[model samples]
Target: EPIVEEMRRFLDKGMELQRLVPFAEVMAELAWLGEGDRDEALHLIALAEGLAPTRAVFGGLAAWRRLLSPESDPGETDGMAEPHRLQLIGDWRAAAALWARMGAPFERALALLQGDEAAQREALDIFEALGARPVAQHVRGLLRQSGVSGIARGPRQATRANQAGLTQRQMEVLQLIERGFSNKKIAAHMAISPKTVDHHVSAVLGKLEAVSRGEAAAAARASGLV
Candidate 1:
């Protein structure tokens, strides 16, 4: 409880300063500490949001509460910020549950599409459990739009790429390039020369038949190479 008390003091100070970042950090610490004490956490989160209704604090507080109680109403908060936060943190189950609770078919479909297969299936299952057939059907439609036949059932198995294509070293270079890493950073990661990294990137681009590195990355992702 000392930590909570300390966090509260910090929260107050941050509010007095009208500084949102410190207040957001303290609210996050409080949420983490108040894991089993969800009612207290919710109260603290409400206070934090009331202090500065900024997107960061609102999203973080909503995410913490949704993680703690997924069946709570998603519309209790405004906008897509909280849902996106949950997705970014890989708390897809809770995100799905919140969407289900809100009974928003389009939002549920979007959540399922943005998540991995396991998460999509889990969201569908939750919708089914809620007896939300229309939502489930919407989700199925989204999957079909993405060229996927039905709800993603499980994780896709990794397959070995054609050895005749780019080598593992080339793939590494390609991934780094796509991530916008500079030659020096790529060299540090691969323990190679900047020149060598540049050469590998060129090779990857040529092999992928793409004009630009960005295009090559898009092609790779489309081909399920990355």
Candidate 2:
């Protein structure tokens, strides 16, 4: 998915502008690093920096720029947040531990992706378990670049066979839908990207043969799938 598209989803959810500013920075950084849209990334970075010109945010933007052009020094990490500084400095093991303590599985996995092959493998598993296909693909690319062999070429088998073909993440999304949780709520509860939640929701609807979330919930209850 386009980084801007995901960023737009966050904006459409009516979250606080302050809370969303960081995500804009994150998506901009991802775009710069992950073969996403450079022009959009620059636009987003400009917008976010204009909105929240905090030292922490500036440090993050500067760090990402340094990553893109390694010869330029990534100046002092004095003002950057601990997690952002750790990940940008390639100390992903420490960053992963910090995210784990904070109960952010997706972020922890992202940090792990910056570590050794073993750590990257764990990151891959976490991404797949969360149904974050885009990040999982990115992790796969990293593993391949590191000369690791025998990586699985598809979703885990358990994800394919569980609960009438509902992946574990999909089942979680379905249960949340049954409880009338919006996609944003489900994303928050699962600690995964809203984009991943969207994919799971679509899959759940398709597998349950329902036209809407309410109908899907009713079918799931009628069939004991939830």
Candidate 3:
């Protein structure tokens, strides 16, 4: 059966999604599907309503869930307050404008999808420019439905992960990490210093939106990137 169909039945049955699991584990799995499961995602977000006082995974997930759901209130985003405020108020054009100024191509494109015709076209351009094939395809479908043809599809020169915003160097570092290489070994293999390898690892973590090397490696593998 379709996962979404199964999930709907499961939710309807009132089955305990967290049986024998902690709230964090449940939230972790749901976070990846938040876009498709906004109702449960909102429930999970409510479980951790207040942002944790520190840099914790639960807090991060909660904030991300809030951002994905327009029904939810504005949440912190490492300090992108005004754009989020505009988003909360349903002003995607204004929010996207701020996102562009903030150099957040992903969020900007997402906001543009919510905006007017010109904004949607700009979003499509940004998605194509970023080599984000999947998102670009979705936006293309939307544009085509709106009777837009002759849109430039730019060169889709990169891998499927261009949407991930990871640099090539970071991708290499992540590959080595998945092979169980430590910093020193990765540095030796890459012909770079250990400190540099550490930097690359950190960048991989940030780009993957992972909290640790292990989680980043798991995400890379899950995405079939290695």
Clashes of each: 0, 0, 0
lDDT per prediction?
A: 0.58, 0.70, 0.63
TM-score of each: 0.30, 0.52, 0.41
Residue pairs clashing in model 1 are none
Worst 10 residues of 3 by lDDT: 27-36
What value does the lDDT take at residue 6 in candidate 2?
A: 62
Point out the higher-scoring one by TM-score: 1 or 3.
3
**93-151: candidate 2 lDDT, tens digit per residue:** 88899989998898788678667888988988998889776567656766788799999
Model 1 root-mean-square deviation: 15.4
Which tens-of-lDDT digit does each residue in 1-226 have in candidate 1? 2353454556666555244444444444333332124455566556656665455546655555554455655333445465656654656666666776887654554456457766666667666566554345445544566676645432232443332155666777777877888789988887765645665676677667899878988888888777
Q: Relative to the unseen true structure, what is the Cα RMSD of model 2?
A: 9.8
lDDT of 2: 0.70
The list of candidate 2 runs beyond 4 A from truth reads 1-23, 26-35, 46-52, 58-73, 156-226
